[model samples]
Target: MSVGVRRVAKGVGDFVIEALGEAVGEFVLSLLACALLGCLVLVAYLAWSFSPRLTIAGAGVLGLLLAHGAWQTFRTSTKGRRRGLATLTAAAFGATAITAIFLLLYGTGCDCW
Candidate 1:
């Protein structure tokens, strides 16, 4: 291929990659999701070990996450189905966390919401 053609191809490739990365949030979303999940795990541990009071806090945070997931899942103007899928996944995780919190509370004879 001609050098000019190669240059154009390389430039197009670079532009497309950068555009997609910025539009899709590259790895930023992944990092935030993983961090949130890690925190949930830590909180669950703390609630189980230190005190059941932390379970109340976990329930509140998980409820927020669940609501966000529901909101995203119901959005109509997103560019792609990935957004809905991610939110649905988040909703599942939130429900699981909430269940865990309830179980801990039950074990403690609290049954707190």
Candidate 2:
């Protein structure tokens, strides 16, 4: 190949590599953010739903969410295999986090509207 063609090919290859690296970095960051959100949600739910008599069901749900968040963190760190499971866990965590946040914000307050 001509020198100019070789240089162009090399530039394109570098661009593709950099883009892939950025994408992977963004994915990992997103996963971490989701995990944090899940943790926050679990905490909020436990706090909000706590009663003077201590409800067992509320505690159980909090435990489940906490365990799921931990499991997702494990799967995400071991990224060599089980990509499908990791993705599902991350998505679930994000959805649960959003739900919990909304519930905490709106479920208790009535006159804030």
Tell me the tens digit of each residue's lDDT in model 2 across 1-113.
99999999999999999999999976665555566556766876776677623555666765676567657755546445546655566566777667767555544432322
> lDDT per model, in order?
0.66, 0.65
Q: What TM-score does candidate 2 reach?
A: 0.43
Candidate 2: where are CA atoms >4 Å away?
Answer: 51-113
Q: How well does candidate 2 score on lDDT at residue 93? A: 72
> Each model's TM-score?
0.34, 0.43
Q: In each prediction, how many residue pairs overlap at the backbone (N, C-alpha, C within less than 3 A)?
A: 0, 0
Encode model 1's per-residue lDDT on 9-107: one tens digit a residue. 999999999999886773454454555556767878877788677777777876777766766656674576555556675667667667566545433
Question: Any idea what lDDT model 1 has?
Answer: 0.66
